[model samples]
Target chain A: MKVKVPKTLLTEHVALLERVIPTRSSNPLFTYLGLALTPDALVLFGTNGEVDLEVRLELPTEGEGRFLVPAQPFFQLVKSLPGDQVELGFGAELSLSSGSFSTRLSLAPDEGYPELFFPSLEGPAEPYPLQTLLPVEELLKALSHVRYAASNEEYRAIFRGVQLEFSEGGLRSVASDGYRLALYRLAKPQPFAKKVVVPARSVDEMVRVLKGMGEGEVALALGPGVLGLATSGSQGAAATGKGQLRMAVRLMEGEFPDYERVIPKEFPLKAAFDVEAFREALRRVSVLSDRQNHRVDLLFEERRVLLSAEGDYGKGQEEVPVRLEGLPLAVAYNARYLLEALSPLSGQAVLLLSGPTSPSLVRPGEAAEGYQAVVVPLRV
Target chain B: MKVKVPKTLLTEHVALLERVIPTRSSNPLFTYLGLALTPDALVLFGTNGEVDLEVRLELPTEGEGRFLVPAQPFFQLVKSLPGDQVELGFGAELSLSSGSFSTRLSLAPDEGYPELFFPSLEGPAEPYPLQTLLPVEELLKALSHVRYAASNEEYRAIFRGVQLEFSEGGLRSVASDGYRLALYRLAKPQPFAKKVVVPARSVDEMVRVLKGMGEGEVALALGPGVLGLATSGSQGAAATGKGQLRMAVRLMEGEFPDYERVIPKEFPLKAAFDVEAFREALRRVSVLSDRQNHRVDLLFEERRVLLSAEGDYGKGQEEVPVRLEGLPLAVAYNARYLLEALSPLSGQAVLLLSGPTSPSLVRPGEAAEGYQAVVVPLRV
Candidate 1:
């Protein structure tokens, strides 16, 4: 079998597959990427047992063939080739030729390659509404805001995924690690009403693909055990295009914990301060905090907030003015957790507190409709 | 004791001292930075067992006092302070106060600090001319060109230092690790004729300080066992300035190996190629080379060079045009060594090969006056 494709398009397709391929595996066949050539198009598949990605490029071919090639070296070689027409020939071995460069690659046994099945979007036996169109930018923004809060602990498999809840009004993305929680709400409602928990690793791969896409719409489909996302040139012509990229990830098997109870509803003290100024103060004072606990004390007064940290080596303190209402309070928090939560906010931030042992809430000062972060305070 | 100094100047002095202080040491006193305050100026000192550094800042004080503070926390705290005047107070403990912040730091025992001695430039029994003035930019440029070639092997102590040879014609800096060598020559001659071996760590610290200096002159002083470098304002006002910064590094005790015999005097094959193009080809081909040997074969023919690498996983090949002369030859080299040697060259590069087994030399295409790099080829 033989095929001819533009060098630039081939390079782009290989780069997308490289992100999903596993670098090392006990089974030798798992380390190779599978390529199937048909009469109309060439399909590339890569999987790490949990998440699988398939990309299709429109190319005119002569015959049907299937082969597996080592992921690392082949990806690197194609990236270095010049932007011209590239010819590929396959038999017992694979040969790639471009310009004055030609090399032969030994192929892995095709018998050990796993069979891949993509979930169908439209079928008579389908139970759920599997097709929904979403704006690409809004989906990326919602993931970035809540991905960091997902837990990495393997014991509790439920917290290792981010929950996507769809309602009549909007879509809510929530993540929690028992110590902190982040909630992001997007106000673009769709006709489908369902809930799904996507694994953290799959969310990361989705973000990488979405960032490179042009201004368009992404089509999402959910089946029994898998979730698929596909993107093309534009919204109207998504089904028929020159080429398309699709990713299917296995959904988590457990139920996520209830996070609404974690957020404190009643607050006796509220303080509004500049986000930049508060972040800078925490950065300076935390330099002297204990390395293990990273505890920093915050003392709220009538119109000011004092931050201090004391360690075996020395002590540090800083003062920043704030607009305070209700009763004044004092609390201790891990400096690292606070820094991560405040880094994404802009302009001003409002902090709500109930008591020394209660969880604290952080939100944007002017708008509290879309996003919120809750952090558990440490004992002073 | 109490004194006032500008925050910017104090931070600069501490930054210089922090480079020489060891974070962990068996002797507890080695982890502290000593500050000795006199009527006219303040002196700061830090040392490991192998190297020592001292800096002076002119400030008015009432009496004399000596104290030692933890190096890490103190340096970090001072860097975070606002750019304003800071006050220092010393009693049983050290106190630092700035704006609305203040902290107390317990001091290490003064008796545990080591005694320091500085070599004099105007001594009566001096044998050689001790002082030579040079531009800061020239000194920094010379150090950056040849520092990467220094060896870090502990068994061969002589190979770990950079040899500084000063003569009537010029100053030469040379470093070698048995496999590769780098030579950098500065054409400004002085009246002093001396040979010294400075440790690699000291050379790195000197580069850091010289990069931070303004447009000024640095005065170098040599004595029995130490090398001193001092810099102030412009050359005209160097002698009568408010304060001056000085650094003294202990000279290495071992004799350096002779490096002149390693440079080849004759070559049978000469190839001139564009540096940028050659570097890009090597980078791409090396991705498929063996991880342990990193061997890449270069085949030199009529007017071109073919570079190729074969590994267990795959194979890569690239062809680059070059101007060749003399006998045709083929040689194999470690890709990492060739990349490092060619990265610093600006224009075209000339490769001079003596034979398949002998070392090859790389120099600028236009001139061979100031710099050269020598690399040994691997057996394929």
Candidate 2:
């Protein structure tokens, strides 16, 4: 089989697919990118088993066939080619030529390559039972704001993912590492009420693809065991005027913890302070905090909050002026957790607390608007 | 001792000294920055055994004393301070306070810290036996052009450093790693004739310091077994108006190999091509080069250079247009060596080759100028 495509189009798609393709795999078949070519279009497939992605580029071509090439070398070759157009000829080895540059990449056996989740281009359109359309920016923003709180320990299973909860009220993105929980809400009713836990890695890959999405709404599909995101047109259009990108992530099979139980319903004490100033003070005072616990003490007083930490190295203290109300309080918390919780917030951050050891609530604005984080305080 | 200084001044000096201070040292004494306070200036010292550095920041103060603070934590603390001026009050602990931020850093015993080579503020100056002054820009430029070729293997001893040669004609910097050699010449004659080999790591620190140097000549001093670099005033002056920086590197204790033996004196064939075009073509063709030797075959044709490489993965080839003279030739070289040799050159590069297996000379311009590289070709 043979085909021709614009260099930029091929390079861009390969770059995106490279992110999902594992560099080293015990099974050699998993290291190859499947090239499925039809008479009028070429679909490139890449997968690391759990997460599969395919991108289609439309161009007038002569032949049709399916082949696999080692993804890494092929990716590097395409990026380094110095011509405006790339010609691919498949055989025992895949031959690629561009201007005065040419190379043949060794092909891998693809008989055992896993079938991708994307719908077949030639098959009858089997519409997903549930589908919704939403702005790509909103989805990406929601994911970025909460994914960092997901537990990185693989053994934690459900806690190592971001949970998407869809209800009549809106769609919520939630993640927790047991010690802290982050939630981002998008007030748009979905076509179906459902919940799914997507692995943190998949959420990261989704963010990468979403950033490259076009201005149009992205179609989201929720199949039995997989969640799909598809986008096409303007943003990454080829000169031939045809391009589409699709990503499917295998949903984690477990129930996320009942995170709402940890969020305090009411707070009698409130301390509002500049987010940037508070972050800086936390960073400074935490320098002398215990390396293992990273504990920094917060003493709420009239018009100011004093942060202090003492360790074998020495002692450190800093004061951040704040608008305090209700009553004075003293609390000890992991500085790292508070830092991460505050990272997604901007402007004045209001910390809602009830006691020294309660689950404290943190909101970006004067009132909780769309985003909030609950951090469990450590006993001093 | 008690003193106060501008935050920026202390931060900048600490950053520079941090480069020479090792984070983990078996002898804890080498991990601290010595703080020596005089009536008019505070001198900061840092050393990694082989390289010692000191910076003097002048400020009006009363007490005179010396103390040591763990370099890493102190560096971090200063960088995170949120005030304009930093105050230090010494006792059992080094008290540091800046506006609303304050901390105490545990002081290490200063009696065991290595004595710095910088001149004492109250003692009579003992001038270096050999001294030369040169523009910091010229010295930095010369070092940058050749230091990458230095051998990194500690067993190679003298070859793991940049050799500085001072003669009646001028100053020259040369380095080699057995496979290739690079030489850069500065035409300004020196005040004395000498030869010294400065380790590649020390050269890097010198480059860092030179970039921050004021617009004036830098004094080069050579004492027994040491190479000294000193610069002061204008660029890094404290608000109180006095500042000075000095660095000393222990010289490698062996004679540098006679590298002139490898530079071929005559060339029966020449291939001159655009440096950037050749670099890109080299990068492209080398993608399929053998992982072990990175060998890329170069075929000098009538008016172009054809580069090709074959490995287990595949084969790659590209042609770079060049102006050729003499007989056409064929040669194979480690693509990495040629690439590094070309990195320091711009515009047209002239390749002077005698045959396929001999050392090939690469010059930046049509005629040999101030820089050249000798890359030994692999017999393929």
Candidate 3:
């Protein structure tokens, strides 16, 4: 296989592939990225058993063949080249030459390269059951707000994914790690019949890719065991003729817990406070919180809330003013969980509590229509 | 002891003390910072056996006493306070209160606190043998260029410190760890009896302090076993009536090797190249270098140099143009050592090579009068 491509274009695609490729795996082939060249374009593929990413480049090429090379070293070498054009030739080895320097790198056999099967959008044999279109920026923003709540514990496979449910009202994304839960709702909804649980790792990668592309439309398709996301090679006006990029991740096969019942229905004790000010006060007082549990107490009064923490080392307390309309109450919680729950919020935030042991709900103060986060209280 | 001080001022001084205190130590007192309040000033002290730092704040006080508090927790509490003025009271426990927030932290006995002995700057009781005044910025810049060459190996005490030699000609700082040697010269020098070896850890703290101040003058006094650095507390125009800050580090007791012989005296092959370009090329090619050794080969021709590194994983090569004035040569060296030695250089860099096995000298191409770095080549 022989191909000539622009350095910048090749570098960008290789960087994307590197993100999906695992640094080490049981199968050595999983650490290598496959490159297939045709007369019309060059295709790059990277996978780590669970997720597969394919990027197509429309640059002109000669001769048709395939090769597998170590992703990290190959990417590093290509990125380091100083010339605008790079010439690549693949045989028993891969040769990359640019300007006055050339390097011949050893390649692994391509026989073991994993086969990537992208679900078809429309086909007679087998078609994806669900297909939807959404704005990349908005979807990514909503995912970022809830992804942190997903559990990192491997024992519970269902809690390790973000649940995406589409209905007549809107498209809702929900994630819970048992201790805390976050829910974000977007108004646009498609005619999807089933819910898709995207692995937390894939959600992170999606955010990274969409964030880099700025504003674009993503075509999403979900089948029985796999989910696919594709972008039609257009980033503003400069990326017109580039080939499309596709990504697929295996969906988790488990039943997600019923989170609707967990969210409190009524919040008798409610208080509204400046988001930034409350966050700052939590950060300061939490410094002295118990290292093991990170517990900080919140004492709500008439028009103010006192945040305090005590441990073997010392004790810290700070008072922040708030607009209140409820009876006084005091509750303790893991400061880290509260901080992470409040980080994605902006402007003023409202806190709703029913009792000391009951779960507390937090939402954006001015508008309570879109997002909500619920955190369990810890015993002091 | 009771004192009222501005939160920002006290926080800044405590930060300086925290840098010198060890996180954990065999002697528990080394983990605590000592605070002594007199009618005139409040003095903060922290020591880790090897280095001692004391900062004096001339704030209004009511009583005279001394106490020791854990460095990290105390600093965290003070930094988290919300009000401008903090009232501190010392008894069986240390109490820090501001506004409506207060914290009582358990304190260690002050009797175990390490005693700090300041070198006499004036008076006949015991005069410092060497005393000099220099701009803090200049001193820090020179130290930054050579400190990386100091060895972290505890067995070789001599190589773990930067040798400071003062004479009528200039103040020279030299550090070597067998593989490389760096020498920096400052023209403004004062009369001194002998050379002092300042530990690398102390040099790092000195740089941090000087860089934080931005611009100031440091009064340096060196005695037989200790070195004292004092700076008048003046930051811009707002800092007035602030007491001076003093820091002392115990000098390493050992015979330093003569590094003068390590620098190559004459070179048959010399080349000049753009510093930034060479650095970038090294960074790129070195990515594929061997994991253990990180060896990169430099092939110098008439007007260009080819940098290449090959490992079990892959190979990378890049060519950077340079101005050559001598015969062609090929040399291999650890990429990390070379990168660090060249980082402190600016603009054009001149490389003087004696042979493939001999030491190579690198200096600023425009003028080779102030600084020189010599690195020994490794077998490719």
Q: For all candidates, state DockQ relative to the true structure.
A: 0.48, 0.70, 0.51
Summarize candidate 3's per-residue lDDT along B256-323 as a digit string, tens digits: 87767777888999989999999988987787789889999999998899999988877878889999
Sorted into a CAPRI-style docking class, model 3 comes out as medium
lDDT of 1 by residue, A268-373 (tens): 9999999988887888788778888999999999889999998887777888889998888889999999987786688899988867888998888977457789
Clash pairs detected, candidate 2: none
> Model 2, A1-380: lDDT tens per residue?
88898898888888889998988988777788889788778889898887888888877667788888878888888897889999998888889999999998888777888877763323223544566777888888789889889998867889999999888888899999888999998899886799999989999999998887746678777878788887754332456444688888999987686878898988889999999999999999998999999999999999999999998789999999999888999999999999999998889998999678989988886564678899988996
Q: Give the lowest summed-lDDT range of ten residues in model 2 chain A.
A: A119-128
* Per-candidate iRMSD: 2.7, 1.3, 3.0
Better of 1 and 2 by DockQ: 2
Quote the lDDT for A178 in model 2. Answer: 84
Q: Write candidate 2's Cα lDDT for B1-380 as tens digits.
A: 88898998899888889898999898788988889888887888889998898888878766998999878778999998888899998888899999899999999877777777853323224545777777888888789889889998977888989999998899999999888999988898887899999989899998898887756777788877888888755433565343688888888887687878888998999888899999998998898999999999999999888999998789989999999989999999999999999998889999999789999998987564688889999997
Question: Which CAPRI category fits model 1?
Answer: acceptable
How high is each candidate's TM-score? Answer: 0.84, 0.92, 0.88
When just chain B is superposed on the true chain B, each candidate scores a TM-score of 0.86, 0.92, 0.91
Largest DockQ belongs to which candidate? 2
- CAPRI-style docking class of model 2 based on DockQ: medium
